[model samples]
Target: MGDLAGRWRELNRAYWDERVPVHLGTAFYGMEGFRARPDSLKGFETAEMGDVRGRSLIHLQCHFGRDTLSWAARGARVTGLDFSPPAIEAASRLATELGLHARFLTSDVYDAVAAVEGEIFDIVYASFGALNWLPDITRWASVVAELLAPGGCLYLAEFHPFSFVLDDETGSRVTHDYFDEGPEASGGPGTYADEAAVTEHNDTVEWRHSLATVVSAIAGAGLRIRFLHEHDHTFYLQRQSLECHDGDIYRHPEGAPRYPLTYSIRAEKA
Candidate 1:
């Protein structure tokens, strides 16, 4: 990593490192509840992935391995990789307490191939809010491609980039450019788990990868896209006007503007 990438990683690692405890204790992650009944995967994503029973799966940028272990609960031999040591530690500890057969390791997404000892997985799964933290979409795609075995697939479920351009207050107005403009230094106080929590190491950086950019990057990484599906709903609150129904799904208010709030991509290695 160069100076700019190194700087971004340094800032982001510290920010995420500090938030592991917050997320683990908060209702957002619900560690106790998770241990009782472990399944954090989205229904649609589960459907797209079909059955992962006994298949090897690798989760990139896995924060504390909730979703990773969720897959393990479904019988996938799972491996989780994250840049934060505290997160990896927490994930490993949780897996031990839960007695799930899973592996948690600390590694930047860009170096996942070597970090995993060149192991290949049958399914490469990445979920919501994972992409924006990274600086390069293309390299990320390459890592995913390398992590997959022949005929294996990469399943990516992410928040739609379109919704990101609009103002966070309301999804109606475009407040930012849709194209990449380098990393945005929008670092501030509080983690997403608890927005008002007082904390140190507030500085961080993130990049926005448009729909086209994300799709093109995966295609360029030599994976054949199986399907790309956009949804009208999301799992988290991305805008003030969004409504939470069933306690897990978020959508536009009954009469509010309707747009793709989340999207999923399935690509296979030839």
Candidate 2:
């Protein structure tokens, strides 16, 4: 298990290193839109988190700092952390170019917590597709708890585990086990980014985490659960058959079995 976890981490690091450059060139992130509206955050994030007028925020696994800068523009003293150096470099450049006050650090989530010791944040924030990359949720949760100030909270918005169960082989069918523990490998086609572009990297690794495991990890870290909100809508079109209502949210087509598409949780350090 230890060997597998180490290998998975190595694969993820390589994947992200390769993906950072591609993601920067893609339109899905809306670099132009971000430049135009520096404060524009994902609707779900801002709506759920409310106002951050004067607070310190630490964003984990912050890819390229779009959302991190968004928080800074909203008056939060923001620090963005990611393992990929290219992503951190791009994020730092973006923060400078936009004239937004944000700090970008290049470190794995675990090391970043210790490296930035003596600093506590009012909020530890992570969102979409962040948790699965981690091999140990308990350690990740502990990192979140460690950096959080007294009365500070952690916020997460992620794709529901059920969404990962869909069979992407040929047609939509339930195949993969939601509670499976082993590593799943994917050749990088049909990503959330442009489906048309062929990626140079072929394989990436991900772990399957259930809802119970997610909640339990945070609770075990001594954080009190505030709320766990689930929604039927997702921020992106995950499946080919999914119908998009306004290009912002997607849902299954008619008669499709309904399932939670995304979920958000806020946990406070006690």
Candidate 3:
């Protein structure tokens, strides 16, 4: 976690710090709706992670804790970890404002073990667009394994590796090599939350990981893969040619061949 990945984490911290306020005010996250309803957990995740009512759940790379608090509202003892101090601070504020019980820790995913001083959880939950920010999936899986109790599970929902290989603008071409082991530098004007919002630290580094690589890493970390599912739709608008459905979810337009846009995994420490 030193050298290049460390530098990339620093850059990412800046990028995420700048995004905190923008995301809080954006319609995508719907902070107002979250405040009123306080349930931001996706149906898919909720269904997969059944009965979190008394479970201890740790959310990795939890940006502003909306989803984490959502778990809190559902009766889970929740803890959130992020590298950006602004995000952690904002999450703390949001928890206090909503009167939800949750803890926010500022630490890189690689340092999460030390941040919590070896506390274990019943569930280690991470979601969409989280894995690309991590450079070493093997080490990340190790961290996930370390954080979970003996019967605990890691529940992950993420943008699919196949989709990550395709060009995001058109979704018709392969813009990047699918199997590249890289800390590829990506930067531009806008973010997924708000296409028009301006930011100074828009650039960030990310890595590509194929599905096999992901599965191998998790298995290497002593977790048993319970199930893997790929979906034809995404929770957000990922491509220009994609069509939005009733719930802000997006998929390939009608009459078009479907492609895997997102994937979820359930792995357990046996």
Tell me, by TM-score, which candidate is best.
1
What TM-score, computed on C-alpha atoms, does each candidate reach? Answer: 0.96, 0.92, 0.95
Which residue pairs clash in candidate 1? none
Where is model 1 more than 4 Å wrong at Cα? Answer: 1-6
How far is 108's C-alpha from truth in model 3 (Å)?
A: 0.7
Total backbone collisions for each predicted model: 0, 0, 0
Task: Report the CA-based lDDT of candidate 1 relative to the real structure.
Answer: 0.90
Candidate 3 lDDT at 4 equals 44
Better of 2 and 3 by TM-score: 3
Off by over 4 Å in 2: 1-5, 168-172, 189-191, 196-198, 254-256
lDDT of 1 at 226: 91
Model 1 C-alpha lDDT per residue in residues 195-231, reported as the tens digit of each score: 9888898987878889999999999999999999999
What's the CA error at residue 192 for candidate 1, in Å?
1.1
State, as a TM-score between 0 and 1, how close model 1 is to the true structure: 0.96
- lDDT per residue, candidate 3, 20-115, as tens digits? 999999999989888999998767888888888999999999999999999999999999999999999999999999999999999999999999
The lDDT values for all models are: 0.90, 0.83, 0.90
State the lDDT of candidate 2 residue by residue for 206-226, as single tens digits.
787899999999999999999
